[model samples]
Target: MECLASLRTRVHPVVVSAQIASALYDTGLQMVVKERCSDNSTATEEDRQKAISNFYMTYTMLSSLLPFVPAYFLTRYGDRGFRKVPIGIPLLGYLISRTLLLLVILLELPIEVMFGGAVVYGLCGGYSSYWAGVMALESASSQKERRSLCIMGIELAYGIAGFVGSLSSGHIFQIHAIGNKNGVVLVAFCIFLYFLCIIYTFFILVIPGTSAGNVEHRQEGNVGILWNIVEYPRSCNIVIVLLFISAILYDIAVAGGMEMLMSFIMKEPLNWGADQVGYSNAAGFVIFFTSFFGVWLFSKFVADAAMIMIGMVSFAAGIYFMSFVTATYLFYLARSLTLFALIPMPTIRSLLSKQVQPSSYGKILISLQLSFTLASLIYSPIYTKVYQSTLSWFPGFVFLLSSIITVLAIIPISMVGWRMARQEGYVSIEGD
Candidate 1:
């Protein structure tokens, strides 16, 4: 009974709510684009694709680029007061953005006006700060030995919520009783979820010993922003550096691929409707659960590096298969092949955490998030442009490029495994 109580207290409701909101937003945005693009009967397919591509690029660019500075400040100073500030601020942003979407649908505002919501979301710290605060809260609440388990638990909750939310969003969007707009019901649901997240974060959630006066101060003593970068690498060995490189590459590839995939599926070959898009997204979310299972099953026999390599290969192969997908079944098959696709990033993070001192984990992770955000800024435009340019002849080119980039990530992982094996003075039996 006490164990259950402890578990209940530790479970972050905001995480689940945030995941649901994200899934709804993802599934709903595509529906919104379809509605907006279809409004003009004379618009060609090419024009629709261009408009979709441009809308996504604009939203992605703003959300990714604007969050950097705010996230830095929030993560650095958030510990001074309520630890949940960083986490809660993003939820507030999510609520406002989702509410804006709902209003847009109700008021029949211009679709491009959603960019304003993205801007508001970005200025409020975005996912980078939110996730960082989540990790910090988990770390603070759990014992050192159980920290990883707590993190995994949080991820599992997120995945489950996303899975359910994505599956339902399509049907929700089809509901006609709500204001007669296409996705009004779905957007309203998202707004409600974000509101709950904000309320829970501020009122119901409790961080263990995280009171403003009780928080520990950084020992680095007001060092310049560049100090972490200059100092931390001195401590990281080749394996750590290689791990960082591989993680960043994988992040960029996944981000670009996902952004392109959403737009790609809505176009020529598949032309998926809202329901089909929901199921496709549900398949993607299932990767998280499958990856958790994969890690548990593989950890009994293989090293962490081996597990990461296997995941990378799975992603590469699945993406390669996706490049050939002309039918929905083939797309599902490709998604199935990548069931373990979610493993590498978390595994790499765990390995990197082991390499650095406890005090430096925040610095390392923040730096990683910055790298990912920067990569996102570049990749969104590049992938959008590539997809638009190749829309007529080879729309699958983006997926193929994603596959190639994923395969390239394996090189650094291999180097890291070899270096680690050498350092341990063992015969480097790959995947052993």
Candidate 2:
């Protein structure tokens, strides 16, 4: 757990900064496109749009290659060399990529440079998959003293580091002037850096376990990977169902909240700037940091189901409250409370880990990402359309929808717990 905490301290801020940098980079690229097309009589609007679409399509195609990359390497290598080898690779790659992307953003590279970077960024996603495999080992380790300690450390680190990363991201964007209206150079630089992080992350996963061993858990038949995923065991199936529903709510609520708050409160009504964004994010981080203790406390005294229920109620209230806040300080309050409502994450993860084999960690993590992405991707267009038309309180409705869905999800969570307890012959409602 301590090691995880330390890693989170370092990694969280880095990832958050990367996110900010990436966003700024995209904005810059768009500005460059607009400027280039402005005076070009030979380029029709449709032509310009087509070019932009093609650029994005290329990037998406690159993304399609990422999930399989680490699996390919694992199948090929099987831990023949150094153990810590994979652990250190991604960190170096991240630094290298970040430096290059920073330079590109500062220098404003050509459109093709930015497009080419799409491939490198794609590679970063691939590199991170190596660590995803390690997480399986952590999950599968005996639930004795050492495993629990390790899990706690990891949870703490992820919370704190992620928060710091998020805070730093806003500040770095301001310092680099990457958020300017016209920021092509910044865009290219950011993407390059993102790719670099992917590479660096590749090295961070040094330890290997059963996946690195000679045992073959799954059958040697010709089943497709997708089929394996669909055939998860009963417990994993339940958790996955819950995770999918909860993650969709979580992502849409989070992304929509940030987008709306930043668009509205960060400027005129709030009269704030990048520094304020940093501070506000820092506050959110602190709240998340504090929640680590809440998890510990809950584990010590409260039932797991109780902790989850508390989280659900808190999260519902937090989401509902976010739709109504006005003052800048109050906005911070809302963010903090919402984050506090998320204290059950580690607990939930710990419980869910009991449901699957360690080798399935990559798939589980991918599923989590997929749920969030599915929500974000589907709602993005709808959210945009609503923002264009009903811009007032419409954004609140999005979160409210999440809250409603979350309430519905709690039912299944409770039901599953109830069924589990029944199977174990426990009769009380609080029984686990």
Top of the candidates by lDDT: 1
Highest TM-score: give the candidate number.
Answer: 1
Candidate 1: residue 78 lDDT (0-100):
53
Question: Can you give the TM-score per candidate against the true fold?
Answer: 0.90, 0.64
- Against the reference, the lDDT scores of all candidates come to 0.79, 0.49
* Model 2 per-residue lDDT tens digits across residues 1-432: 878645632433334444454444433334344444344688754454344434444444444354345433442232332222333343344344445444555565554564444445345443333344334345554463334335555555545655554555444554434456334344444656555555444434323332443333432223336446665557657755775565456556555444444434322345455456556655655655556566666667755656666677776777677666567767766666654465545445555565555444445654554445445445554544444344443534555655675577567567656656664574454474
Stretches of candidate 2 off by over 4 Å are: 1-104, 109-119, 123-134, 141-152, 166-205, 208-240, 259-262, 392-395, 426-432
Per-residue lDDT of candidate 1, residues 146-208 (tens digit): 444456667778889999999998998888856566787788778888888888777767666
User: What C-alpha lDDT does candidate 2 achieve relative to the native structure?
Assistant: 0.49
Model 1 RMSD to the real structure? 4.0
